[model samples]
Target: MMLSPSDRIHAPVVLLVNPAAGRGRAGRVAQAASEALRAADLAVDVHETRERGDEARIAAEASATGARALAVVGGDGAISHAVRGLLDGEAGGGARVPMAIFAAGTGNDFAKSLVVPVHHVARMARHIAAGNTHVVDVGFVDDVPFVNAAGFGFDVEVLEHMRTPGVLRGTAAYVSTALGALFGYRGFRANMANDSAIMSRKLMTVFANGRCFGGAFRIAPDARLDDGALDCVTIRDISPWARVPLFARAMRGTHLTSPHVSFHRDHHFHLRFDTPPMFETDGELQQAATCDVSVSVRAGALTVIA
Candidate 1:
């Protein structure tokens, strides 16, 4: 849905910028976005996040002060943090504030999920001004909100590797880490239960909320923003040699029909792994979990201006 400039809403908006995102360029991006928003005649309060999680803190505080919207200029991680904060506030009985994004991160998976053009800050500003807000669903992993996908096995291992020094960031970084994992990583065993069946897999599993991750890779092509359900993808055991082509096919989302690939749709599920596996939400690795991981969707939980 393309929004006209005249349709833009000039609601009270607070812009939270993460200076450290995208290799310390988020501040500049935020400044540019702020200038564009101001030029559009929108009232904008631009604030720089001093540290990690500050984006969410700032956003929550601004909403408490009667701000109706919170605009974020950063990468997926920053956006995730901000959303978590906003949802936290809502859980604590605060008003639900709408969100807008000015993509500044390396992959901007959430923006891609919304079909928001990454290179069009001016058009994004126009959309913001137009106030075209749509209610979207959010996924929860163990009751915490995640706006993107969650992964276990090889993907989680790759994210772990990317956090080390001398490791690059973005799609290339993920590819490198994925390659390393494919060559040397061993798969884990997990028992998963959905609405229809309970199954066990000895490979990789992904719960997708958004289609694209690690840049252009379409891990879940059929994912819908407001579908009120999550897509669960599990890849059964495959030899290392077979993984090469599988990885290639995943880039184009053509691996869905592979013999090892199994896809399911459900609103909720529980996953139990034989050994604790690393968990990631919106591409950020969380602490290893030994207990059953619960996943669900909050339908129409967030309002986003794309």
Candidate 2:
């Protein structure tokens, strides 16, 4: 279905590209997406991110300028940056615009969660031109917004290990780094509290708004984007040898049934680590300034063309 001619856009759709994403795949995706949008008779304004925080800045400017929509060509990290920008604008009373995501990152976890088409550029362009939109929830770690999962413990170590260059890329790189991390990475201790209960000695905990993490792990099998809540999954302290089977089961989302793991659903949570810790939100590393971090969900906070 398409929007009526009367509803057609008069403003340009801002195309924000992160050239470094997916080992430079985003540049090619941006080119094709731009061509497709132009062919569909939609005006496009292309911009490339050169530095660390460019995605959010460009997205904020686009929304503030009343752009028709913001089309992001990148992976989960880039999209998360854009989400933060959009939400920041919303909080400041700027125009709320729908986002079009072209997944060009290694994991592409957020795009997968939203069922966004990865290869069909022309179809996605048509969706954008038609103004097709869907509202979804957004998760916040302290003040930063994320469209996917916020991870702690083991996954943070996996990301740390990935800092060194290797022959592998994409999901292969993630898995290989994770396997390497398991050998030297011992679990961290934290206290997790929600509206219902408080638990301690957590090895890893995920505040999931999306179903998967690190490309392959179905960390939260039944999470829903618009559910107005989060799926909190935690792994308690276990021996490194014992974690091998747990890792295997997590790939299929069957680890939830394990005694060492626990799952709950809630709208808000407060997590306290033994010390300031490193964590990740939608594949972006974050350093907590203090030992305490708060997570909450904002229902229908984002509009996306899926």
Candidate 3:
């Protein structure tokens, strides 16, 4: 039920702004989004962050104040930071507030997967005003939350390099880094498994809670956000010559049928690598010296405005 203004203790909605997100466009976008929310007749609170971990602090405070919802104004990185804050803040058992993505980031990959009108804060504000809500799954990779997709291998390395400071943003970064990694990097061997079977010599493995990631790569084409199941895709070690066409096909989601590809759905995964594996989630690279990775899904953990 919708609570009246007097019945609500906090502002009806809160916007957590990461100014550095999207390579510095977040500040402007957050301002526009806040204005739009006000125009919607919604009591909106705008909080700007100058450093990392601010989104969570803002969100935790908003939740403590009983805000009706939070609109995260940035890319998946901002959203992920908020997730950490929300989950940690409510560790004592407070109800987690609903969240919406404003999609004002470089890739905005997670927002893209949700078809949330990339980089359009005003329209998203309207959609939230209209009360469109969908609860979607969130993935926990080695205890860190990933709302969109997580992966290891070629893609993760590219993400690591693309995300380096001083590089370009959006798909340009992804494409350039991917080409660089593809031509010079040697594939690695790893082991993967679910409940049924174990596979090794993995070239690339993706555990998806949403369809596309990496600015536009449809790695897990059949994945669904709210399905409560993790979509798994694995590409066994293939020759460097074959990797190019495969990535091209992935853009159109036509790579799933290739003989080198394996697609399935599962609830959990156990991954092991000889050395610390390069890993990425929601397009942010994690410098985790992780030899073993555990991933599982929290169904309907995220309530999003479509």
Question: Which candidate leads the pack in lDDT?
Answer: 2
**Per-residue lDDT of model 2, residues 12-83, tens digit only:** 899999998899889889999999999999999999999867899999887777788999998888999999
Please list the Cα RMSD from the true structure of every candidate, rounded to 1 decimal place. Answer: 4.2, 3.3, 2.9
How does model 2 fare in lDDT?
Answer: 0.85
The order by descending TM-score is: 2, 1, 3
lDDT of 3 at 165: 81
TM-score for each predicted model, relative to the true structure: 0.91, 0.93, 0.90
TM-score of 3: 0.90
RMSD of 3: 2.9
| Cα shift from native, residue 287, model 3 (Å) | 4.2
Local distance difference test scores for all models:
0.78, 0.85, 0.78
Candidates 1 and 3, the one with greater TM-score: 1
* Of candidates 3 and 2, the better by lDDT: 2
lDDT of 3: 0.78
* lDDT (C-alpha) at residue 49 in model 3: 79
**Model 2 lDDT, residue 268, Cα:** 93
Expressed as tens digits, the lDDT of each residue in 72-107 for candidate 1 is: 888888888899888877776666677888888888
